[model samples]
Target: MKFLRPALLGLLSLAYPPLVYLGLGHFEPRWMALPLAGMAVVRAVATRERVWLAAAVGALALAASSMLGNHALPLKLYPVLVNTVLLAVFATSLAYPPSVIERLARLREPELPASGVTYTRRVTQVWCGFFVLNGGIALFTAIGASDETWALYNGLISYVLMGVLFAVEWVVRQQVRARHVHG
Candidate 1:
């Protein structure tokens, strides 16, 4: 029960690009942003986590700008905002110690070795780089691409890319584990 709201929110976020594409066809950008802003607020209230709060704040800012300017650019920048917030969280983890990946790794293996710590830090850095690149592309699409193109990339292509990255990382992690076991 506790996880249901957040799970639903995650699904909504995953559907955002397609929803925005459809909503823009039937409504004003300001009208579109209102629901998103409301959702962000709800998510923040539900999570009470700093990361969610930051995301909600960014969502509000985007919604405000969209409503005030009566433009769709802000509506389209949600992906960029998401990427930026994720980048900040991951990068901050790197600086603060126990990089994001290390923290997750520790969940299963509480006593992670020094080598595992180094590996997870490197993985976190890779993810930070991915966010920078992904966010840049999202920003570019929002600014210059057609609505269909933006929706296609943000809604579909970006997710495919993310899956590919995750799969590749998993493969690498498995190989690393094998090497550690046999070396």
Candidate 2:
């Protein structure tokens, strides 16, 4: 189930933009919005977290507005919503102690040196910057671009960019670790 959860999420994320493009033109956005809103509500109720609660309310409002209206513009905010949430998560981690990347690094190298701690902090900042840039691009595409363009950027381009960032970071981390091991 642990693997299943991430797999399902990945599949759903990949399918979302194209589905939005198809549904918005020919079908109602409510078909997608309502279920997502319901899931948000369920998650909010289960977790009782402020973020989830806020998301639930926002989703419900979006679903209602989309259903009541003929235009699918409200539905087009999907990328903005997702990007904002991710940005918040990454940015907020930087504010609190042990940035998310540092926490992950500590799991692998429990005896992390001072240099490693500094490296992780810098990496975490880089990730926050990436999320900010990506989210800005997503918001811009969502608000002003055609659905096809939005789909291309959010679904394909963004993922490719993230892959590149992850690959680069992994390579750098390996070099840094080797330096620590030899130096």
Q: Which candidate ranks first by TM-score, i.e. highest?
A: 1
lDDT tens readout by residue for model 1, 28-69: 999999878987888888976888798999899999999998
Backbone-clash count (model 1): 0
Worst 10 residues of 2 by lDDT: 39-48
Residue 153 Cα positional deviation in candidate 1, in Å, after optimal superposition: 0.9
lDDT of 2 by residue, 1-183 (tens): 546644654576567777778767777766767655655555455555676567657756766777777456666666666666666765777888577788998998898888988898898889878878887888788788888898898878988999999999999989988988898
Return the TM-score for each candidate structure: 0.96, 0.85
Error of 2 at 175 (Å): 1.3
Model 1 alpha-carbon miss at residue 27, Å: 1.1
Overall local distance difference test of candidate 2: 0.74
Taking all chains together, the TM-score of candidate 2 against the true structure is 0.85
RMSD of each: 1.0, 2.4
